[model samples]
Target: MASIDLAIAGLAIGAIAALSGIGLLVTYRTNGVLNLAQGGIATLIAYVYREMAVVWGLPVWLSAVLALAVLSPGIGVLLERLVFRPLARRRASAAESLVASLGVMVLTLGMCAGIWGLGAQTDTPAVFPNKSVGIGGHHVGVDTISTLIVILVACVSLGLLQSRTKFGRQMRAVVDDRQLAELSSVPADRVAAAGWAFGTTLAGFTGILLAPRVSLSPYSLSLVVLETFAVVVAARLVSLPAAVFAGLAIGILQSELTQFTVNGSLADIYRTLGSNLFVVVLLVLLLAIPNLRELGDAGSAGSFSSRGGQEDTGTVAERSKDLVWRVAGFVMLLAPMLFAPSDLRHAFMVPALALIFLSIVIVTGYSGQVSLGVAGYAGLGALFSLKLASGGMVGIPHLPGLLAILVGAILVAPIGLVTGYPAIRRRGLTLALVTFAVGAVVSRFVFEQPSLAGNLTVNPLYIGGWELGDKSFYVIELLGLGLGMLAVRNLHRGRLGRALLAVRDNTGGAAAVGVDVRNLKLLAFTMSSVVAGLGGALLAYSASSFSSDTFQPIQSLLWFTAVVVFGADSAVGAIVGAAFIVAIDVMAPSGSSTLAVGILALALGWLPGGLASAVRGVIRYVAEQLADQFVAPASPIRGISALAPAALPAGPGAVAPSSVGTKPAVASARASGSTAGVAAADRVAADRGLALTPFGRTLLGLVGGGGTARPTPAPARANGAGPGAAGDIDRHATVGAGDFGSRNHVEGGHR
Candidate 1:
């Protein structure tokens, strides 16, 4: 009976999760775009509702209706028109759409943080009264009953709409293939817009209902809603009924778990597990499920690559220019060493962060693998390094900071192999969710474990019993960065680079061609994880402290976004992105850097290849224009004087005097470089049995020599002849034969 009551108590959360899962499933099914920003939209709507009801003194029903009905759906329509429509029109890849949705998520969170100041608000108003009633020995809250009723009605209505309505059929058509649907006379755009509007309304409802159950904050509610993604994942993003059922089952199961009270150290673990059951379920489902059949095209991760202009071998001038830019970049990277101690301390994060960003570049850019769990690897690195240095880890002796960092990175490499093995089969959003789940699991279980990470310490790098000061350490970091860059350069060149590129461009094709796709992917993952581990260790040592929060799952998303925004494939861009992020955060208020990155990412559709590629394009265009200005145009053929008539072959094709010497007076009057002179020279050359170049033939035709027919001599001009009439007749027949031969030759050559 108590368990039944607990399940009833859990029904409110279950209903909210149902709404969230349904919203996600609907958006994905209708628009063929998984709405990662659903949580963001929910958070935004929840905040607006709270402000309207509590701060602005609006009626509860009015606030709920205005926020859910007006603001939520309006935002959806606006996003469809502005962000998604452009991507759809361009036929952007699914990975691109995924990134855009992430941008939206970050932007919304940033906005909420900026407006609400990151503080928790507990004064959220509930739409349904918090009154309860007894039902057969179990007490149930009115709000809980109302939520269940609402979810049932919503689900039934949606099922009927999808099964019975023409608009729903049109939506299904659009989802199957937007272009085909349009060709079949269905309004795909309108259908997509309607889908988004309805989906976002459900998101709004989820947020409004859940906000009163928990503290209203920018991150808390959003994260809570994000955890509900488990429901959607379990449903495979297809079945609405499955999603609803999963939500309720998980919610009730979580509540039931709370009833158990274990003894000893396991108690805390058990409690944490019960509390975070959704996260655990998400992780387990991602790993346990062999495959998820997504709707529409299951796009590859290659869309993240830069779509720059045509590839060209660098000219000496371009090479020199690139060298100058590289030098300037190095100068910028090293300049921080000369700054004040405080500023230098802040700058220390640059190399470490850049290294971390470069790991993302290696995996996502070079291998086309979508890894969202880099933060997990980094956290593991930090934890392992700390444990090794303090002699807390089993079978490992206390070591100096440098050795610990190295060993920690080396040890983490195998973990990458373990994680990357899953990626051999998974791709796109499935792979993305799997990686994110790994990061979340690590954050919750490993990083948050008091026994493991609570007493961790990070010591600065040391060599030969001599401690390196901040400046010296910074120099070492620069050296480490240089080594990382060198390794990346090696990866980007030669045979190995080509192989990786082949796999990235087309995995199945690479496999068909006998390339070991599995091994190459694992190798990329291993190397990237090592790089991330090294960076994590350096990050810990730079601050001379360790905190799990430093390597949170959200930080992974930011790092990925920053790398992409600055040019995912560009090492220099990674360095610049790190500096840019650090500078923005330092110069502006908190969360400003996130806002900046979010804005740039949102504009990724318009600015393909990101900031670095855009800059390169502009520079290349300018340089080409300048080069064109200095190039001279071709000179025209001068005159027949350049083609001696005496050089004509003395054969059956001997020069005819009538044709060669009767150059029209009008032709001589024209300038040497004129079109007429060029044509006359070509005709004279051809008459002398010389082969005509294509350009010369074209010139002769343009000036009416080869293409135009000559007027026939008057038949027997009154006395059966004029002066040089026989020569004129012979010349005309010879010239006609030469023109025919030349035209045939040109035509044959072209073919």
Candidate 2:
């Protein structure tokens, strides 16, 4: 009876989860974009409903209708038209779309925080009454029953629409290939807009229904909705029924497990697991699921990398320009040391954050793997360093602060192997989801645990009998960064660099050419983790404390985006991104840096290779222009006369020009015994943009006395006109001239 009652009590949350899952699935199926912003949208709508009903004293029904119907769908339509439509038209990579969705998420969360403040709201309006009814030997709240009924109605309606409607088939076509569907005269944009609108409406409903059950807050409510992603993942992002079933099952299972109490050291662990069952399910499913059948092409991970500025060899002028840029960058980095002591301390994060960003460059930039859990590795490093320094961790000796950092980073390297093993099989979104789940799990279980990390202490770094001050510590950080840069440079050069590039460009092709793709991926992960761990340790030492919030899962997303926006493959870009973030935060409001990054990320379609690549292109162009100014131009060649040959040079190295309309000199060489010479002459002619006509070739052969070859007649044009008639035609021919004209002629004639 107790279990039955608990299950009944769980139905409200189960219904909300179902709604979220269905929303996610529908958006993905229709738009072919995994909407990471769904949770943010839900949180925003919930906040709006709370403001209208609870704060402004509006009617509950009116507030619900306004928030769920008008506001939610309006936001959806606006996003489809303004944010995602351009990306779709450009055929952007999956990674780009994912980043854009993340931008939307960040922007929405920032809006909610900026407007409503970060304070929690306890009183939220409920659409259904709190009354209860007795049924089947149990008392269930009216809200629970209402939620279940509403979900059922929504699901049934959605199922029928998807299965039996013309719009649904049109949506399917658009999802499969937007260009093809548009060519086939389908309204792809409208179908996509409708899908987003419907999906966001569901999100609003879920948020409103669930708000009354939990304290309404920007981050907490949004995180709760994010957990519902487990339901969609369990359904393979395809089937709505499967999503509904998974949501209900997990909710019921979670409620039922709360009935049992365990008294032991592992009791807290069990309770936490029971509470966060969805996270556990997510991690397991992502690890166990071998393949996901995504709509459209499964995009390559390497597409996220920049395309320009990868040249290994350059001229002296280019190399000198690079040197000047490096010097200027170093000057900028070191200038912070001249600030006030307090301000200098703030600048400590620059190098540490740059090192963390460089770790992303190692995995995503060099090796083409998407890792969304770098914060997990970083948080673990900080925890380990603190524990080791304080003598709290078992089986590890207490050590001085500097030594602890080294040992902690070395210990954390193996965790990258754990993440890398999954990356061996997964890629793109699946890999991203898996890494995010890992970070979320680590953050919840390890960092948030009072027994594990609550009392941990982080000490200032010291070197044998020397207590390091702020300036000394900053210098040490710079040294560590130099070492990381050295390692990256080595990785980007020689045979190893080429192999990693080959793997990144094309995995199957790399393997076909004998590259060990698996081992290389593992190595990249391990090295990246080491650098991230070192950076995390430095971060803790710089602040002289350990705070779990410093390495939250959301921070990882920001770091990844910042690295990509600056230039994923550019080390200098990573450093500049860190400086920019730190500088922006210091100069602006709390959430302003997030807003700035989000705006830039949303505009990534316009900047294909990121800020670093764009700068490099400008510099290279300038260098070429400057170099060209120093070189003298060549004298123009004298034209040959029609009736007479050109004068020959005085030396054997010079050759006489054939008369106009004669065969090219190279043709005479080919007719003679010097075919290789003809090949060489052809190369020189190509460099000079010289075209060899058949008549010219025959005349050259006769002039050189190599042969008396007859001239070959030109083929008739596609309009059945002779070569002479084709020649008489205007340069801008109509479509009737067919092959005699360019593509514009055909298009113009059709018009």
Candidate 3:
């Protein structure tokens, strides 16, 4: 009877989790994007439901229907059209789409916080009666009964929708190949829209159902919903039944664990297990699942994108741009020191945050690994620093803050190396989930547990028996920042940098070309963690106390979004992003930076490579424009100097007359279909300012487009010209509709 009561207790919650899991799986299966924003969407829809039903006094059923059928799906359709459609059209990688979804997550959370003031709501309205009913001489909550029925209906309905509908077939086509489906006139956009609509409607329903059971806050409710990611992961992001079963099993297991108890630290640990069973299950499943059957792994680079910078020609431009960025960043770092102690104290977060951002740059930007658990490493670093400074760890003496930070950061490197093992095999979304699980587990089992991270105080810094002032300590921070920059630069420059870039671009190709992909990835993770730990240590020391809230799993997501939106590939960009965050906290409203980051991230489709690449391109374009104003332009016929010493023009984009034939000679040349015709055409081409340089001719010859430069054979004489007929190509080609004649004759004729 007690076990039956526990199962009944868990039933409603489990059903809610299944609902969210189903939405996540369906979105991934149909849209080819795992909606990282599902939690955000869930949280938002939950709030909307509470607002209408509880606050506005609307009927619960009416609110539920409006939220689930209208508002939630409307939000999804809008996002699909605005945020995701462009990405799909351009064939964005799963990694890029995940980042875009992060943008959405960040944006949605920001909206909730801005509107709801970040407080928890306990008065959420429930659609079903909370009272239990007697069934077969056993008690079962009406809500549980209703929810179980809803889950059954959802699963069977979704199964039929996918297997027994025209839209479902279209959705499958879009998921398999969006471009191919579009080419086949399948209306990929509409199919995608429908998929998102269904997914978000389910999300809305789940949010509404779960709201009454949990304290509803932007972060709390979102984390609760995201915890159900374990259910989907257990399904390997595919199976419907697996998600349902796993969600129910874990829920019941958690409820049943409450029946058993122990005393002391073990009791606390046991209680935590019961409370966060879902989070722990997520971590376990992610690590133990052998491999995720990623839907679009074939084209996924598993790295943040900067594809918009395709025009970046490596030259002095990069050097010049980097120098300018350094100068500007240095100014921003120094300005904080001039503020009042209170304000300057707040600025303490800047350099440390930059270090954390750089760690992301190293992993995601440099090595092309999706590392979402850096917050956990950062938290561990802070915890380690405290223990080292206070002599909390056995066999170690208390140390100064600086030494503790160094030792703690270095200590985290091995942990990173171990975590790096998964990255060696996984990429993109799989690696992302694994890393996020690591962070969540650490946050729950370590930071949130009093037995692990209680009574942590900021360690003091001293030098030569003297306590450093605010500005001096800031100088030390600057030094550390400089060192991090130097280390990152070393990793991104020369042979090693080339190898990393090679591996980032194409792992198999890099291995084929003899790059040590394994060692390099491990090194990246190791160095990245060290930097993150150092940042975390510094971050803790700068604050009043070491607080777990500072490194919450949600903060990791925000930091990643910030880093990515600013520029994942630029050290200066890391500094810029950190400064932006610190500045927002100091000057703006709460969560403003998050809103800004979300907006920018959602625009990654256009920004490409984040804000950093766009800035570099603008800088280079201006530099080139200025240079062009001062310097002599290059000559098209300049190659003739090397071959024949022919005189050339003084400016670029110019055609030199020395190599071109005169008009009388061009007219004298016969337009025949033999080698003579080829020579005659070449002369005519030069007269028309299409002169082929010696080098161009040679290069063209290699590609079967030699000096002859003949067009492909026109389909049996384009526009119905006779075989062997040759129009006056040069004269008519320079004309209008008449020119179409020469285009046809010359394309069809050999010449």
Which candidate ranks first by TM-score, i.e. highest? Answer: 3
How well is each residue in 386-414 modelled by candidate 2, as lDDT tens digits? 88999887988799887888788888889
How would you encode candidate 3's per-residue C-alpha lDDT over 461-487 as one tens digit per residue? 889888888988888888888889999
Error of 1 at 546 (Å): 2.1
The TM-score between candidate 2 and the true structure equals 0.82
Clashing pairs in 3: 306-609, 633-652, 634-652
Candidate 1 off by > 4 Å: 307-328, 631-751
lDDT of 2 at 78: 93
Which prediction has the highest lDDT against the true structure? 3
Error (Å) of candidate 2 at residue 497 is: 1.7
Q: Please count the clashing residue pairs in each candidate, in the order shown.
A: 0, 6, 3
lDDT of each candidate versus the true structure: 0.75, 0.74, 0.76
Residue 519 C-alpha lDDT in model 3: 97
Residue 344 CA displacement from its true place in model 3, Å: 0.8
| Model 1 Cα shift for residue 222 (angstroms) | 2.4
Tens digit of per-residue lDDT, candidate 1, span 1-751? 4889879867777878988899888888888888988878999999999999999999999999999889999989988888998988877778888888888888888788777867889989999888899889778898888877877887898899889999889989988888888999999889889888988999999999988889888767877888898999999888889998999999899888878899987776787798788888998998888668777667656666663311111234434434533665687698997899999988988898888998998998888888888998988888888889988889878888778888988889999989998888888888988888888788888888897689887666678989898898898888878877887878866457756765765576556545688998999899999889888888888878888878877778778888888877778888888889888878888778878898898888898768766766677678778878996753333322212323322344433322332344323422245687656654454443332211111111111122222122223121234433322222221122233323332110110
